[model samples]
Target: MDMSSISRHEFRLEFLVTSLLFTAFCGYGLVWIEELVISEHWPLDEQRFWPGKSYDLNGYLDIIVAGKEHPQYGRPNILSLRYLDEVARINQYIVHNITVPVDLEGKHYEVAYTDLCMSFDWACYLNDHLTMLMPKSRWGNFSGPIAEFASDIINNEVNITYPIGWRGSEPIYFGALVGRPHLVDREGHFDHATALRLTYNVGNISYIWRKKLASWLTNKEKPPSGESQMLSETAAGEGQAHCCLV
Candidate 1:
């Protein structure tokens, strides 16, 4: 008797259900797309690498060894210090009050040098940038911990020792290892100059972005078990410290 009424009620219920389902699917798709874009935006994989302009970290070990062996420039050492200044200049850029945003393992970090300096103490022109970030004081005032912390930075691991205020008489040291390395000639002579010329204002944004994307994708595809290993060397020069944004 009321067949027309029943049909109308069923059509309304069906349309409402369909609309709700469509809305839910659209919302989920938007979220999924956003995440995908983010993943592509900041990849944190270990397999990616972006060489720095002006001074690519070429021959870093040689530079450290040279800085240790030969205090004076133009002196013949195991490694050549001819191009060390260029690299030092680039490292200086890291602390030039510029900020960099980095994404590692799904964590967002804004890295900027809050404070830094260049010290030529201990008979070597060490980029003493990291010294400012060292913890003021610690339970033990030893050099071993300081050395280890520097190693972690060179190795590209986040192991900075940020203690409270300054520790009296407990100086922290970080050896320069993140810049271009010193090269040497076969005849035990410091080369007059380097083959590559450096220039500031390079295209670093796209370069860094590509690297971050690669790193992120690589990590998602294959997670890393431990800290990254970078080519490094030790020197007798005065140690320097570097700081990173939280």
Candidate 2:
């Protein structure tokens, strides 16, 4: 080969080698960090490490509720949950303000309340579903810091009670069951790009494990038919649910 051609070839080869080295180094670092977190930091046994029913969970989502700040009909605060593969079960909680009225009956009356906007990320699963825990509280009132609400969400304590309007009915207290989907209205609002980036940035190591587990789960089974039906129903219940598409 001519001298100039040889030099160009050498430069290309060097560049290729440098790129490969950088990539490998990054990959190795990711793996090492993951190992450290799982083993030394938040270590658990193999069985406890990945709990919950196995599913592919290609990020199907359900709504929990919408809280409005003004307690008005048109405005809504959004709260939602989604299965982001097997590694992360995400909670997106939005708050709103509301007011409900009940007429005084001779014998019975109803108590109504409205939602008040907050941000939260409740933790439902740990180490890609190894262990699950509930947050201490669900939706926080608008008076607190958003980060506190987010911390509560990650801890899995997101049970919110919103008053749409006052109706004369018996009072019932309740809590959410773990592994159960939220009772969402028909519409949903989310920033997919933002959530995805947040997931990776917050749990980049878990993402690596999630991809592998998700592949295995997908091969093992399919999403439940009942769940599919429920999701479809939500889509159909848009107007009744008072939701806006996002």
Candidate 3:
């Protein structure tokens, strides 16, 4: 081959190789970024932790009432009458401020309290859910923190002061359950029983059942009152029973 042709061929080969390497590096970097985000925001364990039911307002109310009645499961002061009152006010505010689109059937349904709380600017849903699921022993003096959090939420404050141990930035849906020592021991060892309790009792089974009940209630054209009693009983049972585990 001519000298110029040989030189051109060499340059083309080098260019192709460099482009492939750049593309591969970019692909790897993207994958790593996605993994990091998922681990911090939605851990694999939490993604697997589906409650298998939709959350409705009544079911959440049932859970709140049950928590108030049985304070041993969570922070005693946070589950008091005052807390219930605040929650009711917040619910009203949400109903008025937020406009949820109606279904095709033209039946207007209020947003589920749980759904609203979860979507709220603050981490109210995570705080309440963890407070109820985690034993009171694990929670140390959350009364003051939770009270302030609730008040801020009620006042529609933009800058929220999150409770200790709860993530304010990059909120994780159920990342707390996995990060806490409840699933792992002091030496960073995994506890099988604790894991089972979290998976079956708190996350998988009980949570799923409550969600299902909530879904059923919201889906109904005219939900009956009898199910509320059953839901309340189930919530009470879950609070009392699940708290005793691990």
Residues 94-194, candidate 2, lDDT per residue (tens digit)?
11111223345555433211111111232233121112211224233344588766675544442222212111232112222122223354322111111
Question: Between candidates 2 and 3, which one is better according to lDDT?
Answer: 3
Predicted model with the maximum TM-score: 3
For candidate 1, what's the RMSD?
20.7
| Clash tally for model 1 | 22
Q: Per-residue lDDT tens digits of candidate 1, residues 106-193?
A: 9997654321111112122233322332232322344676877755444443322222112233332212222232435342222232
Model 3 worst lDDT run, 10 consecutive residues: 192-201
lDDT of each: 0.33, 0.29, 0.36
Superior candidate under lDDT, 1 versus 2: 1
Range of the 10 consecutive residues with the lowest summed lDDT in candidate 2: 193-202
The segments of candidate 2 whose C-alpha lies over 4 angstroms from its true place after superposition are: 1-5, 45-63, 67-72, 75-246
Worst 10 residues of 1 by lDDT: 237-246
